[model samples]
Target: MVPRRRGRRPWHRSRAYRLARTAVLVTVLVTVVRCGHDMPHGGAARAGHAAAARPVPPPRPLPRSPATTLRVPSVDVDAPVVGVRLDSAHQLRTPPLDKPQLVGWYQDGPTPGETGTAIAVGHRDSRTGPAVFAALAQVPRGSRIEAGRADGRTAVYTVDRVRVFDRDDFPDKEVYGPSRRPELRILTCGGLYNRRTGYTSNVVVFAHLTATR
Candidate 1:
């Protein structure tokens, strides 16, 4: 007699498949909750109080010249810095992959070493592996950052603190706020990686413009 074969169940109806689907859904929900909604700089009550406080200091003068290069000996990042306009496709213009250590400056904002936070960004790694800013995570408070301007001047800054924030929770005002003293904010991705979400957090190093040479 000939033997007959049994039919297999569809994937959607399988117990293992159903459990996996449920787990994935749960994970996504949890991630969303953890990320949370964007909160304004302050609530109405705090806004009123802040307004009553002393006025914010004026922004520092833009150099009679703008910077053209950025170098950080401690992190071994030395690359030409380009002006990144607000409307530019990318805020910061980075160097070619060959020079992965290079970072770009947001031209729309304060120049590095100027009052009001100056923003600079670099990659933590490339397809090959550790890239410029790769050692950024290891940078401690008090490290020096230097920027060379085309007008024959250089601005130096000293690290103040390193902070990590979820990408969704990026505190724009705090990072870009005006300051009486010149400041710098170096940023890069950090934290756990999710195959579906990429990087879960950002690492920011805050530095104060301590001197110019």
Candidate 2:
């Protein structure tokens, strides 16, 4: 990750995202979320990460801009982004399964670099094989996540924690809550895979803005 510049520009203060993130983001595939047994999946990936990170100084938020790309170096995920909306069922929709390499941004929420929790979701793996976020659970704390904005600026976030939650007990607030500072959440299906119920957990990566360029 590149070091943040010392001399910073003036930042804009904005409100937290007010829309309730009520949509259950349970799968990349609308019907079922699946993952192969080859790698660390689900509960096994929930190693405590709170102790692994260094304290980060707060960073000012940038003006709202649609994310164009998302890059997670540790996970080897580099993909173009598309806006995802909630379906009539109020379920969060994902990118096309055929485009396994693409990531979906919650278009109804805050844009990356804004003063709120922005969200991005991707498939852990698709039929084509390991997809964009296939290794998301393995991303270590303190690593950087870059969200490229349409404005040609980039918002750099430092991973604070990585956790896997049982889908039945997913925390709606903690994972999708509004924030005073610019924050981000990267999510994917995780935990154990069950034939009848699909993946049992949701892998969530919590990160906060540390720099912009």
Candidate 3:
């Protein structure tokens, strides 16, 4: 008989090869488990992706009406309130100063005499001196705010409270929320003035409609 040549067994019948393959398979499974936490369908990964994909709702609309005039008898603020358009830049337009006191309405928001929070902004001081709203900080709760509209209607509001806020932390919701009773928000710069940072805070007066005159 011819001498048989030595040769390797087929993989399915090799004990050493089977052990090596099992080792490699275990290593690969371990690596996948270690990194699976960060995979897109993993628990933490799914939460992160959902949060990033969520949409933010748009801001609510302001009330609407004809142009109106605002008057605060306690602070001696009487001016023709002109509508400040809501521009793409999202800025509150400054009213023209025919006199020292002119209140500008944020056109994007609720109009005076409407059942919602209406914003009226004015300059705290002019180049000459303290302008309209110079005494805004002194306005107390229970004070009256009046708005006279060109459509032959008048709305009266009572001061509810006043607050100061850093521009960075402006309470946009509370200051601009909808109301069953007409509301008013008076905004102006107050607090310490920083040469580099501009005004440190904003003075806001909150008032609720008391009556229509």
Candidate 4:
């Protein structure tokens, strides 16, 4: 009945139009947030989260070769290696007492330069006298140890630690367990000598390969 408004359309002034405009704006905001484009910090947060989820690389595996010799300059050891297998009792046999200077390596296990644990056994003392590893107990951490392989390669290692375990409390898994890197265990009878029962304990040197040639 009244004259029409000067120039604006009637729909433009309606509540429905205002509500539609507001809804459109809300939808745009939701999309931005969901896409990680909401603001200045959103992109950076996504990048940081992606970095945190990245995977770590696994350790590199070492080469496998039969050991031919062992040298420990600190202990003045330059011994020949011999392959030894487990006995019927499932025990590592001692190197022959006649060859007290000989070192025994487990033939079925990882070689000295291999990725897994490698074991070298020698006698702390022989019936005759002190043996190749008689001075093994005196070898300290951080000392250098080297093993020459049959392939003419050399594996150089650093002593990490030395441990003595009683015969009754020996940790089989710790000494012979699998490892991610090349490892060496120099083992021998230790602790007090028991004429009736043999040695009362075992000496173990834990070392890890640091170089190869």
Candidate 5:
């Protein structure tokens, strides 16, 4: 009777609905992003760079020379270093419990200034009293570590990080892995001390060569 409406005036195609949809479409926004690793080409790249944003190169590594002493000023540690090897149980031996003033260096690895990882181990305490690295865990990042070598040169390193690990689950690869740049690892007993079991964890200081004298 109403002039036979065409499919009841299809709601989707009505003028009111079409105007609302067009308004929504106009309000929508789209953004596209692309990431790249390659540097920009030509002089345009140089013009956009600021002096402060320029990256500085790392220091060059020094020649091999056994470490003779170790110093950590932040914790007031200055101890003579002596060569130490793995014990019968295949563990890197610590300095003699009796000579708490001494630091033990892992002789199998590169010297402090050399282009590889070097290690120094000391006791955190002994039955007598506090030992060489007693406050090693307190050392903060950016602290200076100096290693006196046999060549009468000092290999200066800046502390990067300090961490404590349970002795049973120590990470061998991450802690002692091969490194192309000069590196030093300082270790001492840490965590809880048990009357029967001694220390439950190990404190390690990671550092890298930064200067020499």
Candidate 6:
């Protein structure tokens, strides 16, 4: 009667164990495929995205130029410029009365298109009559000025203001001060005429560089 008992199967050969093994094999295969995709090409794609997201740098600025000619359309001032040195009084030398049509540029200071105040002085009038810059005061605000440079380029400017300061209170620092960008100082005799003291005031035109050609 101890009879008929059936033997149990091993765990490795059971139907549930076989299904688990199949599931594990499928999961391992899927993981291997996912890892392969994420390794080489995915890394390259991230690098490409990073490079595309980078910003481009700006271009460099042009070099400075020396002024040769000056033109102001508003006042009809189109004149050739000549370089002159400082006088014994440590002042900018004036153009000869005989050549009142010429404009004098301060040679020791910044050039026309350089990064500082460029001083240009002219005779407002001569003993005979009107001079080159005689009508400079008539130039309105927001006028345009063009200065030809030695580098075969023209520097364009816009007149910001025109001022007449008495010789006793001339703002030398403002007119000839150091600047971060190219500036222009157009100067001439102005205000009341004094037989003993000459011109009682100085006319100054302030202009800033706006364009270059």
lDDT of each: 0.55, 0.68, 0.56, 0.63, 0.65, 0.59
For all predicted structures, in order, the TM-scores are: 0.64, 0.74, 0.65, 0.70, 0.73, 0.68
Which of 1 and 5 is ahead in TM-score?
5
Model 4 global lDDT (CA atoms, 0 to 1) = 0.63
Pairs in steric clash, model 2: 42-191
- Candidate 1 lDDT (Cα, whole model)? 0.55
Q: Clashes in model 1: which pairs?
A: none
Give each prediction's root-mean-square deviation over alpha carbons: 16.3, 14.6, 30.7, 33.7, 27.3, 40.1
Clashing pairs in 5: none
Give per-residue CA lDDT, model 4, range 57-114, as digits (tens): 4334456678899999999999999987655533455467667889888766777677
List ranges where model 2 is wrong by over 4 Å: 1-57
lDDT-based ranking: 2, 5, 4, 6, 3, 1
| Candidate 5 lDDT over residue span 1-213, tens digit each | 001114322111111111111111122112111100000223334566853443446677877778799999999998999987654433455566568889888776678788776778776665577888889999999999999999999999999999987756666555666677888888766677544344556678999988889
Residue 142 in candidate 6, Cα distance off native in Å? 0.7
Report the C-alpha displacement of residue 85, candidate 4, in angstroms: 0.9
TM-score of 3: 0.65
C-alpha lDDT (0 to 100) for residue 136 of candidate 4: 86
Name the better of 1 and 6 by TM-score: 6
- In the range 72-94, model 1's lDDT, one tens digit per residue, is 77767777776543322222343
lDDT of 2 by residue, 52-170 (tens): 34455566788878999999999788899999876654455677766778998988777888887788877767655887887899999999999999999999999999998765556
Error of 6 at 34 (Å): 87
Candidate 3 lDDT over 139-165, as tens digits, reads 877988888877677777788898877
Worst 10 residues of 4 by lDDT: 30-39
